[model samples]
Target: MTSAAFDTSIEETVEALTGPWRQPRQMLHGQTYDSHASIHDDATAQKLGFKGGTIEGPTHFSQFAPLCERLWGKAWFETGCISAHYRAAAFEGEEVQAIVEKPADGGNYATIRMMKRDGTEVLRGSASIGIDAPASALDIRLTELKPLSDAVILRDIKLGMTTASQTVRMDFDQNMGELYPFSLEQKLKVITEPSPYYAPESAGSSPWGRAIIPMEMLSVLFQHGSKKDRLPVKGPSVGLFADQEIRLLRGPLFVGEDYRLDRQVVAMSGSKRTESLWVRTEVFDNSNAPVATMLLNLATLKESYASYDQEYAALPRS
Candidate 1:
């Protein structure tokens, strides 16, 4: 079904996962993640003659994290999980909506999408959750843990060394103490405005009653799409890790401006079963403006985290 039909029932709230996402304009370009930058000025995306800027894949995939959390509960952060491949980009100013539909077999399967308000599909994906799956297995029942560092970015090596300037909106000179346990005053400084997709109540009131980075936006920024080169792999094997540590210095990200996204490499090590790399990222809303930053450690294995890719290829419609 189209976004219109899907969105027609926001109140029902019976939707599977995603919902009527607002296609806000100003929230564009200013904020981004690894994948977002990776795709913007790449070779294949350039040569294939794709129109407009290449949309990052991780940006799209993480967009749904909020949906899962909203439905499953904030604590779901430690419980539920998702993993998917991005098929395409959702351009700036495009009308976007997200929806989830169950597949025929029904068991732990779904069809999800990010669509332009006009009904033109932007990003189409699949979804599955092991509901009955033990919360312990998902770590939903686990106690929250604080990072051993001020947010561990790739084992050390500050997040943004290679990140060059690109257009972004908003600006921030954050007081690290103000984040984490964001104060009433701090909340006012960040979420300067509100929009449908992610609305901060008001300057005096916090978005979801807390001052923090727009989780959805932040998730997309972490995308490693065209922005960076994929880890070199020898086999079809893949490695995956859940959970992350974020330290938001500032921002509920405003609109109508330019920003810079900085990425710095952290650590790389090899194991008998896998190889991995870690990196730190700092997002500045406008030129030289520091809003919020994150120390993300992304990992991949020399061999698939699952079994052999050959067996994966044979699985019915993942």
Candidate 2:
């Protein structure tokens, strides 16, 4: 199940598969949302107490591909799922490793984790093959969420609200826009796992016959045009990914392929310090065939919203 293109030696045992330590690059330093600098900007993040601009969470996904591919083979690209709940932010220059625990019964599902060299956890979740792979990490986390209440930032959003389907594509050198200002070519230069399967000239020689988008880029592809959807969540506040799940259906989504994305607000949740908006985005091909899906929990920090307490106090008590 291993390939030279994946370019990494996996440390495997009867219990787990461990990937090499990788220093994920930060490409979101200039990222903007709602016309303001995002948490990926050092100055903005420092205002809220982060030591520095955080590397976007999905950037870590690339490190797990080699391990997951070794465990499941090509099918991991076709029907694989990675569902993670962020435990802490990872910054540039920090070394992190990915581990996928082998299923006890050798089934199609397993738990996964990423940790810094200091043993600080970056994220923990599940990975599996098959659309029906037993409840993923986010699936379990969703059921446990306390219904959102006393919210200020996400008070206007409602469940099942969908956005207009929009078209998206990722060319090798095309910048993905404000939310992700870099191009696929720039990312490939530093991707944790380099695969010819993701390159134009060499892709035709691969099993898929065309370049397949790396799992991490799927996040960019789906989110590229999302801001235009304008789903009505109060903002001018900072939000970060708290949980995320990317699942492929009839995929190995190709690089340079055009896909339509439709997003929906599927759930709302709250914690002591943040209110979360859970969204589900579906990707479809030109012929309208289902390609992939993503579940993201965009958690807005309460303290970052200046009017949070004042607004919450104005709400009628139950």
Best by TM-score: 2
Best by lDDT: 2
- 10 residues in a row with least lDDT, candidate 1: 1-10
Write one digit per residue (lDDT tens) for candidate 2, span 1-318: 222458688999889999999899999999999899999999999999999999889989999999988888888999999999999999989999999999878688999999999999999999999977899999999888899987778878889999998999999999999999999999999888999888887887778788889999999999899889988877688999999999999888987788999899999999888999999999999999998999999999998888888898898887
- For each candidate in turn, the TM-score is 0.37, 0.97
In Å, residue 160's CA in model 2 sits off its true spot by 1.1
lDDT of 1 by residue, 1-318 (tens): 101101132322344654556533222222323222212333423433445444433344444545543444333232233433333455545556666653344344445666766666665544444445322211321133222222111223332335443443322232212111122234333332222323233322423333333443444433322134233333332223222333334444543234566665554443343344445566665446566544443444333333434443554552
- lDDT for model 2: 0.90
lDDT by candidate, in order shown: 0.39, 0.90
